[model samples]
Target: MSAIQIYDTTLRDGTQGEGVAFSVEDKIKITRRLDRMGFHYVEGGWPGSNPKDLEFFRQIRNERFRQAKVAAFGSTRKAGRPADQDANLLAILESGVCTATIFGKSWDFHVYRALGTTLEENLAMVADSVAFLKSRGLEVLFDAEHFFDGYRANPQYAMAVLRAAQDAGADMVVLCDTNGGTLPTELKEIVTYVREALEVPLGIHAHNDGGLAAANSILAVEAGCIQVQGTINGYGERCGNVDLCTVIPNLVFKKRLACIPEENLVYLTDLSRYVSELANKSPESRQPFVGTSAFAHKGGIHVNALLKDRQTYEHIPPESVGNKRRVLVSELSGLSNLVYKYRELNLGPERDSAEYRRILNELKDLEHQGFQFEGAEGSFELLMRKAYNGYQKPFRLETMRILTELRDEGHVYSEAIIKLRVNDEIVHTAAEGNGPVNALDAALRKALEEFYPVIRNMRLHDYKVRVLNEKEGTGAVVRVLIETGDGRKSWGTVGVSSNIIEASWQALADSFAYGILKLKENGAPDAQAP
Candidate 1:
């Protein structure tokens, strides 16, 4: 099969997703990144829709991509408006992009109700739009909006619309599953029929309302579509568009069809997360292929099978997509988890020794008390290290006190006093913060920074608290997960207690200890114990 073309619309259709908006700079950054990853086309946005999009086109005009062509997106000329005179078409021409993607109503229902125009008029709109763009020496991708629904309702009219664009010299006539209601089986059949009917190259643009956007796109490619249109992380209106992240891997690895270069495939997970960060959205941990938990093994049977052979639990090597296999230790974990993790961490432990069994029992008991280790590997590492002989703690906490009071100014004031034994010295510190936990963190850092200045580089990245039993309400046991980073990498530590303050302190202390250990491993001079 020929290589499939990837068209990314994250800056265009993707912004239609709720809470997704990008500055012009953000769009340009993404364009360069996509180009580096070898995407065929990047749809900048609809130039005529908003000032931000128009400004994006203006700024992007002076930029050059390595291999990817930037395309300006817009709708067909308005009803009764000449293509040359239409503002939307004129804006596309002014955008200075080499290619233009214009969507025209393909469904009879959309033509009458959405566009409020007759079928013949909509056909003329598509034809005129494409012919005009081609006349301007721009490659035209004529998007047949709602094509699948159009075909279902009025097959002849939908085919006629595609034919109109083809006759008007469109480079490709894209079929869009606008409502995202099409099934893979029927979608493949429709795409096959269209591929047989149209002379122009075929493309599939799918939405994920029915959760089959990736499946539908793959099936469409098998049915002879040469181009696939989607957004990074599947960002789009409502249920989202097809995720190029998911589709690209499946096509390259499973179908043996080419999309992005195989070497570039390793950066797929980073790209997905980078886009999510720029969009101010949390990465979906359960998303296939690129998700954090995609290759994580939790069950004992699964881990045991994986210990002997990874293929027993995984479909592909995690490294193939730039992801690592995670062996999580929990109450459900078997000795296999401990064995695998020991190998991973290079911890010395005999497989059949009493110490190993003791550690395993301790882990299970802690988990039974609501200590989750899957998301808190740093804490788990500390637990394993503590079991080692002749292990010395960097610091020992002596006492800590927190006081909070509401002042007359309608603000709460919190202070923490902490005492610690660091090496041979006694350190005492007091600090104030907006909250009790923050105050404690400040006090602890104030005490430790004198001995381990590496502690100064570490700060809490995220802190999450989950109630183990909500029925207990105020007295409920809480599990606190704290993520800390030292400007380079981050680790998570977990703590559980009925007292929220104690839980936070446990997680916080583990975070500091883990950060110090990591720094020492990396050869930081200040990371040594005094």
Candidate 2:
């Protein structure tokens, strides 16, 4: 199998996404992660654009990459200026990288109208830029901007641009679908033509405007392109760029191509999540191979069949992409569904017994109450414990009250008083915050911390609100999901109410209850049995 190179452009093109911004620190962290995942090349950023990119290139000197090379991205020098005197070309040399990638115009219209340069001058720009970068002892990749559409318009000039880069000592000539509107068949044809026209290696850079970036990239590879440039999660301008997450798995697992190390493939799912979290973007649930719901089974029949034979429902084993199979308990669950859920919790149901029906009924009731166990495994386990053994409560809610004062000047102050009983002791506390929910959380934690000091380490990491029944007007039901972390483990809890404040309070209370329950369980005398 031929080894294909993976070039990650997440720092440059991916940051062009709307509302997506990464600081210098974020860039360094993401680059280190991509390098560790065995990517062949990482385009840090355009060193001439911002101070952050300049600092990134400067500060990245001491780090050693095991498998990835760092590439600095920039545009070709001006049409008339000598490449040696162009500031953009000089910045690429000072970027402190061994590889430099420069994008030059391939479209005839862009060369004449946008650049205001003649065809011959544009070709000289492409050739001279590549030659100048190579003269500085740096490997160069020439990106043929808008190569596919330009080729479709004027194939002869497009071929000339590739020939110029080849003659200019470029290590590779990368054809770019800059406008992102090229179809797969067109990409295949043009890539084959360019591959035949160039002696140096060929590469592809595709966008996702038509949602064909990944498809076009793969077709280019099939047509003899050796390198693929893409972002991590398809983040870029407009629709986005080709997603490396989908491309890498497809090449290695489906196409039988060599790109990344075999061991690094197992970390793909984790790496995807890490990037998404750092970017503050939610990972798509239906994303191929690495999404949370990619291999999740919710229907009763699907769950039952998968329990007997996984291939009955799953297209690929979840573990193949470093994800775990999830049997979601819902209104559609059957006896086998409950059995699977119990087994996952390390519990067993009695044969033909009332406990099975009881658990099933409980799941249906919880689903009706808007407690989605599909994404809240911790809550599901709590429900199982309550149904099977009638587990003892960690703390009982004695009383809770919220007070909000709004002055004539529009200033508002909110306070909460919470009382709870742990074991036989009753504790009460009051606290103030910017909102009633925050105050309630603060007051409740204050009361619990006196008894369980470890509660100080727990915090609410994320909160999500959803309107369950929007047609109900003021009486519409809402669901709140709260994620809490205690330094080591994170769990999600959910609550539903007609009022938004009440819904938030319910979720917050569940978060604290779950944390206390986990602490008690870990501190129990029989905990050592595990």
User: What TM-score fits each model?
Assistant: 0.97, 0.93
Q: Candidate 2, residue 32: CA error in Å?
A: 2.1
Candidate 2, residue 318: CA error in Å?
2.5
Q: For model 2, how does the per-residue alpha-carbon lDDT over 55-111 read when each residue is reduced to its tens digit? A: 999988878988789999998999779999998889988989999999999999899
Best by lDDT: 1
- Model 1 sits at a Cα RMSD from the real structure of 1.5
Off by over 4 Å in 2: 349-354, 487-489, 499-502, 518-530
Kindly provide the TM-score of model 2 when superposed on the true structure, using C-alpha atoms. 0.93
Residue 348 lDDT, candidate 1, scale 0-100: 69
- Which residue pairs collide in model 2, if any? none
Candidate 1 Cα outliers beyond 4 Å, as residue runs: 349-353
Highest-TM-score candidate: 1
Q: Please provide, for model 1 over 425-493, each residue's C-alpha lDDT reduced to its tens digit, 9 standing for 90 to 100.
A: 889889999999999999989888888887888889898999999999999999999989887777899
